[model samples]
Target: LLSIVDKLSGDSGIGRTLRLAYDFRNAAAYLKYLWFSGEGEFKSFLPWGTLEPDALRGEIENILNEQSTDIEPALAGAVEQARHLKDAYKTPLAVDIALDRAYYRYAARNLPEGEYFSRWMAVMSDWANLKSFVRVINFGLNRKLFWETFAEGGDIPAGKFKEAIDLDTDSIPAVFIHTEYGSRLSDVIKTALGGEMSGLDLFFRAKLMELYRYTRYCIFGPELLWAYAMTKQEEINTLRVILRAKGAKLPFEMIREVISVVLE
Candidate 1:
């Protein structure tokens, strides 16, 4: 990335974009734990951290005054959504959902437009909503409950999601048929509805791999860095999956089934 930026003319600040993003992105971790209870419940998607609730809130306040942007909407939405989540303090899901929505809607800044990474973030936001939506349907959750978590910047619209989620379970897949993800995700929805939940996880990884595989063919550019880093990350993720499965004594076929998606 520095190499690419160096080759550009003066006043090109793309080199600094990623660093600025990480500064606020890391701040999100502190915001998500604002309701933490030190009692050690499995409370978040990210790994547990040492910060207490007070400290987390203080950190969020600083970010809100600093970035003076997303940190507000992200937690502000959660403040409203919290009333609906009766056990909001016990689980971080509501806040996490709020953050997801605010993140795509406002958090993205300074991305290199037209780059794969920018598109990747938008698509990941969509997939995250899709993954969460699937659970809402399968678990009989209220369709309205998902609105706070709905993300922007994707091909799909929030109202489109609303209409789809309002449908009966069997008819839901039909709503996505004309969307970009239709052909690839139609069967994924069916498989998830069939209760093979692990398939959804594999599908997410597979779609990410498929969408970015072109980076691997770029022989002379910053994309080569993306391809190399993706390869390494996939290797580590694959090994981690295998180790966890083997540690649990999962059958050989099961281990193979999960790891196969890493490369595909």
Candidate 2:
């Protein structure tokens, strides 16, 4: 995927955004590796953007060897923020939430505003925030943490999430009533609140697939490429689910239930 995105040339906005997204993922992974393993090696990491793989490896090694705080500033900053939150709250989830917020913020800053790709990313961010909200609420975690974890750049304002956190489960859908995702995802939100956690990803994937359908009419553009990439990812996810089910010797019906209907 990184190679394919890198090969695209001449005003490929989506490609550039994808490369940055990949970089964010790699950077986060590198930080997590250092935090857990107490060592840094980029042998298994994907390389893209302005950072060369060899240079990144060397920098990571230097940081590990000298116990230096010097690393890629963006990733280093995110890790530091997460570490601060973890120290204050003593929850590992703070690390994930901080990294995710940074990832979405990076994407939003890099992508052009008001474009389809940017809107799609906003929807993704909204879905992530919604998922985090559901988890925090359902698990009886601290509601105050939501404010810190909320990723900016979503179509749904952070204020809406703050308000929704106080509402009854039945009234939660009202928070999104005016947004583009409201109609499509309202039922999913209700279902998720009812304890169907898997529905969250299922609903988001379905909406994303539906969004990609419009790109089918375009003869040429990044939309088609984006759709293809999304479809391939869906396919990969489906295969992984099926493979896991088979390995576990799960019933066919059980496997079928976990399979996403959007791809079918």
Candidate 3:
């Protein structure tokens, strides 16, 4: 994988980022396996001579960081620019609009959640300055929906769970069926999906975010989120290909088939 990344880094034109990203993924998987097994002299294989695993995270971070000066600079610059662009919005509507723009306009959907959400929050901070309503609505919505996740055993803190869901039972008929969050993940998921019809919007995005978060932390114990990220990575490359084709005055119809709607 390291060799592939080196080769991809040296290559020019034609989906270079995609090739690099693909190789990076191979490294990520290998590092994940090593960390999970908690065995072997993994340090011997790492190119970073003196680095050691401070946590399970050391391997992948080292690869991306130590790899040529190019990777770190590009990643840092992209992060900085994303944060800068997000600061332009100054209202709830503006914040949402900025996110929407970043998603489709700048191919922001291709970024990892850490980078993507950081950008979102930076934009949101400006929007909050213009209108307190942004925080009120956003926090109220998040806190209310967070309890629903708590009540459904969504890996949220147990101590905060009960208080968060302390709302009128009479107003919420669905909560009555599942009095406490189930211990079993299967039960939690079933109740979350089959019960409750009031908070669909929050539920879906929350679920996606949770899946994305865990997949990053836990690797491919669940397949969907990893697939989603990779799918978006491919989309980023596809968009670049389209831009390049247009610049070179080539037909784009054939390239369109290469694009995928989802990572899988």
Candidate 4:
């Protein structure tokens, strides 16, 4: 990327464009490191020694401010959607549904609303309906009870789990992060959805990438858009690791540790 920028230095107009391109590319690399590395290393990789949630929120705000200038039409709609998210809806599931709606509406506006879009819209609707039926009885916030309940594959005792839990027991998507094209996770989603599922790591990264691609032209875009857009190859690499561990039916502790690391 640096080389690409250097090669364009002689042309003033192109040089400025190349510089921004390089900055975006480098930012992506750092984002990848955050998702793929362990918590300790991720801390070491940052100046503040932590992936502060507030910092993330601030950074996103900054980006939106800049985007308002770079692309006013796109950013304006995004801001309105974000406003709706903040003042009205408070739950993750609610936020997710709103984003999905904004994304599909944006897609319909830009695309021909072909069969592909129709199918995905249906799938998204089904997922939303399933989310509504998720049994979210309160499980106490104790770590032991939380882990035990998750392991037992049943509802947690009152006060053990999060109040807004939306973990669907019937249709959990698993990504086989380590496996190749013929691997279980990739093949299943690919056959079911029908798309360019190859080249995907078929784990968290693949799921995220699908979200990113679907919503790139949307009004509000995805919440993880920055992380998804920035971290390309390396982000998917760690996803493969998580999927492989899952497929092996490893102990819950082992799987949880890997997931916590990836999502940190």
Identify the runs in model 3 with alpha carbons over 4 angstroms from their true place.
1-14, 39-264
How many Å off is the CA of 208 in candidate 3? 19
Q: Which regions of candidate 2 fall more than 4 Å away from where they truly are? A: 9-73, 112-114, 168-179, 261-264
> Which candidate, 1 or 3, would have the higher TM-score against the true structure?
1
Cα misplacement distance, residue 214 of candidate 4 (Å): 19
Tell me which of candidates 2 and 4 scores higher on lDDT. Answer: 2
Pairs of residues at least 3 apart in sequence or in different chains that clash in candidate 3: 91-127, 231-263
Summarize candidate 2's per-residue lDDT along 1-264 as a digit string, tens digits. Answer: 545755653465656666655555665566565555556444656655546655555665554455565444665566667666767665556667777787677666655444677767877888889888987777777887777777766778887887789888899976777776657577778888888978788777777787787777766656677777667667777888889988999887986755655444
Per-residue lDDT value at 190 in model 3 = 32
In angstroms, how far off is 208's CA in candidate 1? 1.2
The residue-by-residue lDDT of candidate 3 on 193-231, one tens digit each, is 344322332233333444344445444221333334444
Candidate 1 Cα errors over 4 Å, as ranges: 1-92, 102-107, 194-196
Superposition TM-score, candidate 2 onto the true structure: 0.74
- The candidate that wins on lDDT is 2
Task: Give the alpha carbon lDDT tens digit for every residue of 22-132 in model 1.
Answer: 333344444444445444542332222223444445545655455443334444444445434525333455545554554454435433345576666667777778877
- Estimated TM-score for each candidate: 0.66, 0.74, 0.21, 0.31
